[model samples]
Target: MPKSLSNSYSNNTQPPFMLLIPQEEWQSLHEKLDRLTDMVEKTQRDSSNCDWLESEEARRLLGISPKTWQNYRDQRLIPFSQIGRKIYVNQADIDNFLLRHRIGEHR
Candidate 1:
């Protein structure tokens, strides 16, 4: 039988094992968690502010086909960044592109 079971059967008097941490170590862990949480929040805020559009999203926003999107890239008509094999555009750049190519009078 296991020591725990033997103890329980024999005496039933042993207290449960407890894990202990020093106050300073616990405080340090809490501080680290807080810092990590702050960093995550800041990252989310920054990403929200500087939104990025993927290739499909840009194509959909422009109402263009994939081939047309590729043509835009080949002709350097749009601003984009290629990371690895994926392309990304800034949301602000897409907005400006639309503004610059507006066809009719604003109402």
Candidate 2:
């Protein structure tokens, strides 16, 4: 059975200096943690790579009314991130969004 963390404060005083983990389980856990760390790092890098436009600027770029922009954001039609109280939209995300929603039949 795996040792309990509470064993640290138990009357046993010395407590268990180390806990034993199975070799396979340890390797699997380490790999999973590494993958998670890589994903987080990649996300941070990508978020910082693009030029993020503030709400007003983004609305102007999209040629939409502030209300309309708010509507899209509230409906999740737009992708954005909030820093403190400010909202920022990634330029690439906006471009991709527009391209994805373009009309199929043009007049």
Candidate 3:
């Protein structure tokens, strides 16, 4: 192969300004990237759905402040999940928590 036609980029001081990919490979890569993006978006939507309530949301639903909510958690009155720095409680658990504290019930 000629020197000018060589594919090596290590000899250049500056990085390659442009990349050339075959049309077929470019299209395939684009499709794969789109699919991965869709999968990530779907996962985020599913995790952040109404079934999992954030701290402020659950507190608002229960009509309590941050301290009271923390106390409830400490006492195990409700169940929660900690993902990274965010806390979440299941909607059904919130419902059960309220029901357990009911003063009187007909049935």
**Which candidate tops TM-score?**
1
Question: What lDDT, from 0 to 1, does candidate 1 have?
Answer: 0.89
Stretches off by above 4 angstroms in model 2 are 1-50, 104-107
Estimate every model's Cα lDDT from 0 to 1. 0.89, 0.87, 0.88
Give model 1 RMSD, 1 decimal.
Answer: 15.0
Q: Summarize candidate 1's per-residue lDDT along 33-93 as a digit string, tens digits.
A: 9999999999999989769989999999999999999999998888999999999998888
Model 3 vs. true fold: TM: 0.51
TM-score of each: 0.53, 0.50, 0.51
Model 1: weakest 10-residue lDDT segment is 7-16
**Candidate 3, residues 52-99: lDDT per residue as tens digits?**
889999999999999999999899889999999799999989989888
Compared with the true structure, model 2 gives a TM-score of: 0.50
Q: Which candidate order results from sorting by lDDT in descending order?
A: 1, 3, 2
After TM-score superposition, the amount by which residue 98's alpha carbon in candidate 3 deviates from its true location, in angstroms, is 0.6
Clashing pairs in 3: none
lDDT of 2 by residue, 1-107 (tens): 34665554656556446789999999999999999999999998987876788999999988999899989999988789998989999888899998998889877
